[model samples]
Target: MRCRIPETTLREALAAGATYAAIARAHGDDPAAVRARCVALDLSRSRTQGRIPPEPVLRVALAMDGVSVARLARAWGCHPDALSRAARRLGLPTDPVGRAALRGGR
Candidate 1:
């Protein structure tokens, strides 16, 4: 089944400080989908907003256990490549899947 949550309502709720996850729950939509939309919106504003990522969040992303870059990006509200670059800056592993594949290499 499809959700009845209007785009305007979703945007309003998020603008009012309601997280995309909360808005999705309230509207019976997928949180991931809502979050993706929100991230896209945020990226569109990044050019003019000058928002900087927190250092702690970068650390958390680098140290996240068994977390994929895609998952980290979702949590940090940014692109996977951004998180990967941050990890590289910290000398942490960048490609999770590549590392996993290497572990099984003969």
Candidate 2:
């Protein structure tokens, strides 16, 4: 079947920051059947999800001499990779210097 979203519905959704693709998906698939065109979808989050600590807190933890990324991630309720990515993006080291040396990498 074809999809027909009312103009008011589309306008309201867009004004509320909903993307066209999101609205299209909500209207069901087969968008081409109705000649509906939507902006490309980007699935990545604008901000990372999970309980990543604030910069100062993360800095203190990363600054600790013997802390491991895995341990930090566990304590912070995030995956190790997520923590690492967040740290790297913030220009902080993902691994403590001591642990990096122990792992034989900088």
What TM-score, computed on C-alpha atoms, does each candidate reach?
Answer: 0.37, 0.44
Model 2 over residues 1-78: C-alpha lDDT tens digits? Answer: 555666566666666766556777887745453234322222222323469898878877876666788888888767
Model 1 bad stretches (over 4 Å):
1-63, 97-106
TM-score of candidate 1 versus the correct structure, residues matched by position: 0.37
Clashing pairs in 1: none
- After superposing candidate 2 on the true structure, give the runs of residues whose Cα lies further than 4 Å from its correct spot: 1-49, 96-106
Scored by lDDT, the top model is: 2
Q: Tell me model 2's lDDT, rounded to 2 decimals.
A: 0.64
Give the distance in Å from residue 19's predicted Cα in candidate 2 to where it truly belongs.
32
